[model samples]
Target chain A: MTATDDRADAPAASIEDRALALLARTRRWHWAEAAFWLGAAASFALLPDSHLLLTEIAILGLFALSLDLILGYAGVVSLGHGAFFGLGAYVAGLTSIHLTAEPLTGLLLAGVAAGLLGALTAPLLLRRATDLTRLMVTLGVAMLLYEAANRMAWLTGGADGLQGVMIDPILGRFEFDLMGRTGYAYSLVVLFVLFLFARRVVTSPFGMSLRAIRGNSLRAATVGVPVGRRIIAIYTMAAVYAGIAGALLTQTTMFVSLDVVAFHRSADVLLVLVLGGIGYLYGGLVGALVFKLLQDGLSAITPQYWQFWIGLILVVLVLIGRDRVPALWRRAVRRGGAGA
Target chain B: MLTILIDGIAYGMLLFVLSVGLSVTMGLMNFVNLAHGAFALVGGYVTALLMNRAGVPFLATLPFAFLIPAALGAVLERTIYKPLYSRSHLDQVLFSIGLVFMTVAATDFLVGSEQQLIQLPTWLQGRFDLGGVAVGRYRLFLIVICALLVVGLQYVLSRTRFGSRLRAAVDDQRVARGLGIDVGTIFAVTFAVGSGLAGLGGALGVELLGMEPTFPLRFMVYFLIVVTIGGTDSLTGPFLAALIIGVADVAGKYYVPQVGAFLIYALMIVILVLRPQGLLARGR
Candidate 1:
């Protein structure tokens, strides 16, 4: 709130201080990003048989990151982000089947298709609405897509799922093998590229405008910011990122299903962002890693009821601060140091 | 068509009861409780269990349905939900959604994942035709009970002194508290009564809407649709909204058959987009 007020008094700040603040806020967690990539690379070597799961984590990370773009930064709480993901997936799957089998082209096509949809849909949804109305609009759109997918079985393969999705080798190089090595590498590269782009997006002037809008849209508008255009831009971009993630999933897994657009996918991504903490780029990366591992570990013991444990964890996370896990850890460490 | 209309009205009535609690809580408390469906699930299970195992008459089990959820709502509101009253909508959404997941899994574990069916009493099993519209005897019973409940609720909310106190508390908690209104007690009671109504709806709806562990997740959208479209604050708004939705849905399914639930979502989006404050906007 004060930041927007400071906009009018911007010239008062020293050049040195402004540069330092920019650097501090924009590139705050370089080490965390390094750690994330290092861990991801290391996982490929350490766990020989877990490429598939690792690939899923990468996909989930991207999905959560896309959610983080609008929800984390722009303050637009969407409950139907999976719509873009599913659209990307179905597009990629259908493109490979009908148009071309090339991975990159299909991914690009998916992104473009989902982005266009977002651009068209954003105006209708980004109107002045309460949180409840926004949730309904997003959820309704997703459900409509889900229903369409379910009903259009003639084209989508309906309940049986979009089978026989044949994808070509990555850049006419490494092929998608049975153990998912190529897929893992491909997804990781895409996630990294998109993560960097997202990082750049969130730290730019437009990103600052988004945060301003999130903090106080009215105030931002009064301060000469184009709030609506910025929102529409970011919303479309987020949809594009989510579309790529969906395309990645379909390309890697070689399957497309209605679950991609399911409500739970949106919920799960939100959970990932929550666990990792929002408004930070690496929160999606860290949250996805932990959530996937926890799901895998917990499901092994109770395959049929892992949802209960996840639910329990979510409840605890909300009860405690969703973003305070790191703070709590630091506090405990400090207490131990003092006691010792 | 007439039969479908009657059936839709009955369905809508059931939806109003199930969703009215959610509308009330969201309007008064401004908390997004996604777990409202879970209470309805609880009530349905209670009624189903009582009828099946204890040989409790279908009507006899209804009271317990309301009582159990009301009691549960009271205890949970005090222990779990109270702290979240002042939290942001994000936190509230997350907490309530988590509650929904836990309750769904718990119910699944407790009462097997299979659908639970209730045996209607012999009197309710018959259908009568009135001038070409064949109305189920049980649907008529449901309509009568739900209509009466709606009237009772409207009376309590509009006419009673407690209603004014609750409204004042919702309008401005600090101001109401300053004026000597026990805001906390009113909230707890409202929440309990709301949950009880949801339970009653659940018990009655078991025959129309199948009861299972997935009940919460499956019908969560419908509950939200009713609450959001009807306007979060008013009783009649949700009531009318639910009727419109239920009728549109039933008629759409009856006529088209292929596009299940498509019409309702479309309608909800149109209504919400045009009237973001809900169909019945309160002048703030």
Candidate 2:
């Protein structure tokens, strides 16, 4: 009730108090968000056979969410986010094969590994540069990693991909089965937990600083925000998110392929993020759901030539203008509210 | 070593011709046309189809290859790309990438996934030894044609009336428009010409780079590298960058084939880190 009640007392409140109220308002969960999560949970029971597909949606959603953190929130354009994702996957695969098969531990290791790589690479991305430069560097780094993996055939299994990955059960309870039920549940749980963490982070004061930086870095710097450091932090955090998503894929599928780090993976995730909408926390989740469904449907219709349609949709979407999409969505929502 | 250098120069020249068009579009309009390779693919396909199916000589098909993609580029510029010039870089990137995907899929559907080989005339097929450096007749022809193109492009860009107008347009579009320059037509023409050049390069490079449905996606990074490293301001930067990349790539492949494209990518990252703008970028 604090969110609803604070607006009534806003006029008399001090500047700090009003800021607190605004923050609280943003932090308040909407009914739609609750319903979405509830639906995700409900699907576990309602759509038992589609758990495998749902699991892919969950991982992709997380991956897209990671991209959203930088591209959507922080205004950083990256073309090779799959670098961290692939790294996480490769790390998880190696850990399962060479060390332990414990799922949580593998996830932790993957996240840490990706985070470290992100931290190391953050400086390279944080330099005074254009978006094109960022794209080339990010892409170049990913390609370098791909080539390295391809060369280190002894360790990575080369072009054939790293196989023989064995993942243990979730907390030593349920075993992974052929139907992928456990995988879906496990991935969903990880996604939900991470989503909560991301939501909390984005709603905080630091997140506001990121928004300010995104809007105008020069002005943000003049306002006493450390633009460079904030970018590095958010980028590293996003990398961890992507890495965790990759780790989930490896854990569920028990195989890591070169395609994980392929250029298409990066492009696909970008498309998903764009489809779901950007900036908002739920965009990735929504986008992943829509993208996966679209891919499935399109492939079903024309397995080989589905990319043409996907490309057509992207072209049409952009031609219509991404800026117009939110306006249209808002209009529909307003009309729906009136009907309700 | 000499043979590698010759091959490298030939490869570099081919890359320059393919990527120079991209540099102009990116520099002048600041539009990130990631689908530039698609134009090249069209040219390559044109050459292959003409040479194989129609029994046309390779030389005759080259003009059609250029003209067709040039027309395609002009139409696309006026219709699809013109509106996007004012959009954000992200939008431009996505739009072009969409074009790339469409072209790739469409090419695959039409031609199948196999690489298309263009039969070079008998005269252009054989290799000759020049001062102990073995050189293919096709490669030498490529180097000669591309070098001529570079010279011609430089002359057109620097010494011609249209070149100065294009330069004016690139420098300050608003001012150029105020000074009675039709910026839109200039852009459309430049874009078409760039696409035509790319087509020519694709036609010439089929034997060397190979032609496939995924041609755009495969060589996209290389084209981007040339533009970024060459600096989008002038023709010389991309030309030089292409040559450096060409030689380095050839030498790298020859000396340490296992390392593959890793060295070139690492070098690009280092260069970008060192000079964020480019190797020969003009002062803003």
Candidate 3:
């Protein structure tokens, strides 16, 4: 036998190569992603006037998306991201009450305040890769901020949170109605606009650098990524997103609570990200939808045992595996096609 | 002054008990078990349930309290943790956070949301006059138990085979495996032991701080600070760090009532800036 004939026994190299090539080609399917987002946005707009739940989902989706930016892309796991969110909410509430009646300006103030805080804390948090240490430090910063807000009751309205945040008409046209129609529209607009902005950011050179850092910080640093500075910038930007989301919630609801700063809130946001999948931007949106639906449905069914069910679901997710189920299904489908 | 010192010591010892397990897991397995506090909560709830609902004597329920959390820990390690041990820190953190939520929810479901009170047995109740200073006998008992546990742990870690295996595993798991040690079993056992210690701390601490649904998240920060400052692996590190924190916490509360609550965070930030490796660099 000739060398070529002998190499034919080398186990279908071309088949494997072809499969890998197909996978590589399908990996960058942006059209499918765009279609998915469009479908989600359309469905959201079509949802009836369920003001409280819809508004909450919108705001939380934004919050989760903010987290997705840093966590999914940048790989910075923050247990204190709520600090920015809460800070933004408080800032928005305070500004609307004390400074400007304009809801748009309130949102701007929130993002700016939260972004600045993120920038300040990023220096300290960016120094370590020890997840535990980072978790603790970020958590500590949040606690400190919470304590400060609690102590400065005179300014923050303390535990009562800022009340009577009168948000003026959006650009002197759309008034925030109590039925939540206006609120939902406002949040939807904000979410879509921010989503577009975030989408742009993720596709930018900065976003590429973030992904590079997340993949391999040491290698990225070696290749002139300025890993520390990138981390700080991403963290700060995430804070802005989170802050805006928080402000949106307050503006929509016209009230804010110290619960925004609570550790549970932070933990819940992280949970949402995990449930939806962290690396994908849509993960946040998906997680928020699933979590909020589960929470609302389960709580309505059994208020006392709702948490138990939630916990059980989480444990099952962890035990059964996060990514295996989908992968297995895909394989099964492919095999079925091959057989056909 | 003596009271403050004693109170601080007692509080610190309790913190040390709760945090050492977390420190070991973080140091050895490189896993951030957020559910560490959940184990403590489990111990507290079980003990409280038995003592109050089951009408079991407080002293008698001690073994049940300890064993329950230990078993739970083993199950958690085997089922949940084993798979995630090799995962990224962020994933582990998320997994543990899930565990925490589940534990809290389960506890709340099993036991009512109302805070459960644990009455010290008649023998352990009340005060003992300490040369003109009155100290609670239970506090003294805790002090004694803590001291013994610390000494015993130090001895085990320094002299025993399991200790050596644990150290080897922490240093390098592949190398330890090459040396023929059952690394998986060691990990499970270590996790159980650590969890057991947390339960003990929880059971004992119930009297000092009542058992409530919010205890896990509320006390989580304090525990994290202790473990973080103590450097996650060294037994003495948590002990010493807890003392410093406990004392500082008390003093801060007394002097600066406004920012008193944040003193620990300030301390944590300072430590992070100065010695990010923790006060006593986690096990070499």
Candidate 4:
């Protein structure tokens, strides 16, 4: 509000600011670690027969996390994240069929493919677009890809889906088993590693710049943040994450279908992320778990009306408050803050 | 070619009626309601259920389609949508999408997941051949009804005191309130009419678009395309945009039967990129 005092100067003041920033950045949030351990420990011990569901949850968590990167931190709204996810799955599926099936390499390749696609499309997408514009553009891109895949059935297997996807043993060591234990464990490891990487990124200086941009893009630009470039970079990075999530799904399931590229994937992930609460690092993970569990429990009871329940939840969530449900961990945070 | 044009016009007219109310709410109220499609679905189901089950005449069922949804919409607006006028677009999208999901599920549970058939009256069933081309009897009916609706809507929106007040309210809520315009009532009425139009469109379009539990999700893109591409401010923009889209969709399907809806989607992307404010929005 005070424009008269605006100045970036004095080496001593800048150094002191840097020191303060470093201390604030390095502050440890206990809940994130708590969530990781709780998910890893509880799922394995409790649901021995639910490896497949757990694996799916893990993959979805990662996908939701990717959405959080742009939507929560960078203020970029995309409605077609499933494009990268489907692309990653298909790319990884093709790689397994046509190249090596090393899990890490496939994931890496998927991430790169999605990232490259994001980089190429973003300039076109980000051009003079607002919320509604971005939403439509993202959706348009996804639909275009979907139609292309459907038409090129020989390559994408069309509606029949890309079949005969056989992945080799991870690191040529642990073989994928019938019970899906290996898939669950593999996905858990990937989730943990990526979660670590994301934690590091969000806690860094660049992440703070993203928050500033989200709060006020004009002010951020005035303060020397390259707004367009940063948005593009984060969008591309989110795409890579989504791609990797897709790659994980294909690897675990050994199948890639047109459904992977559908609008519901994007919508579902967004729902899960927001359900856990936007902007929090672990929101995606927590949302994925709760959403999957709800789906499982509700579907078992009223199989035909499961969607109705989900819809009811959404209406209630919106009506009551965005911060009310799914993010139960907030209580812990609040209680901790109060105690301190 | 002429048949495609006719078909496109009819189709586009249907899109306009279904979505114009949405345009009013979105443009004037500045609220994004993705649940607009659900109103259409409700209308379609109402028409189908009454006509098929109760032996009601199709014409008699049309009023129910429009009125029932309008009533429901009015109630919903007063209750849920009022508070969301100030929320972020993301929240609005989520809330509406959730409603859509519930509506879809509820419809599926109630009516079964099978496609609801609209048995049109014999008078509107057959094709009317003009020169060498055969235009659908039902499509002609659609064009007439939608055109009348458009004229009525345009007249009410542009020529009526209510219209000016509504527009004034949209331009500035506080100023309109200061002028003693009941903005809330205007919005509620508009929301009802919009939902009613969606119902009428749904009832009209069931045969063309196919009505299943997933109708809302499927034709959502088309409705959004019409609204977004047409621009936000005026009815003519969406009307013209809908016409072009209808023609494009019909032509695309006719010529490249294998390509399906790819052209329309691609065109939408191009239009959106070129004119983010919409094809007809005046520069701010």
Those runs of model 4 whose alpha carbons end farther than 4 Å from true positions after fitting are A1-35, A38-42, A45-47, A324-328, A333-340
Clashing residue pairs in candidate 1, if any? none
| Cα lDDT tens digits for candidate 4, A276-332 | 888876788889989999999999999889888888887788888886654567776
Computed on C-alpha atoms, the DockQ of candidate 1 is: 0.68
Local accuracy of candidate 1 as per-residue lDDT tens digits, B141-201: 9999999999998898889999888778777878999999998898899899889889999
Model 1: residues with Cα > 4 Å off, grouped in runs: A1-25, A326-340, B172-174
Candidate 4 residue-pair clash tally:
0
Which of 3 and 4 is the better model by DockQ? 4
TM-score of 3: 0.89
Tens digit per residue, CA lDDT, model 4, B1-284:
78889999999999899888888888877787888999999999999999999999999999999999999999999999999988878888888889999989999898899999877889998898889899999999999999999999889889999999888977788999999999889999999999999998999988888899999988888888898899888889999999998888888888997798888888899989998778988887
How should the candidates be ordered by DockQ, best one leading? 2, 4, 1, 3
lDDT of 2 at B14: 97
Q: Write the per-residue lDDT of candidate 1 for residues A1-340, one digit (tens) a residue.
A: 2343456556777754674477457656545456558888888888869999999999999999999999889888887889999999999999999999999999999999999988877876667646766777888888998999998998899888999999998878889999999999889989989988888778777787898889888999998988889888998999999999999999998999888888888788888888887887767777898899999998899887888888888888988777696565446546766775
TM-score of 4: 0.94
Q: lDDT per residue, candidate 2, A1-340, as tens digits?
A: 2454446655778765766677778999876678689999999999999999999999999999999999988999988999999999999999999999999999999999999988888889877657878888898888888888888989999999998999988899989988999999999999999999999998888887899888888999999999999999999999999999999999999999998888888888988888878888877888899999999999999999988987888898899987665456556656766776
Evaluate all candidate structures by whole-model CA lDDT and list the values in order.
0.87, 0.90, 0.81, 0.87
Poorly placed runs, candidate 3 (over 4 Å): A1-45, A324-340, B126-129, B282-284
Please give fnat for model 4. 0.81
lDDT of 4: 0.87
> Against the hidden reference, what TM-scores do the models get?
0.94, 0.97, 0.89, 0.94
* Model 2 residue B100 lDDT score: 93
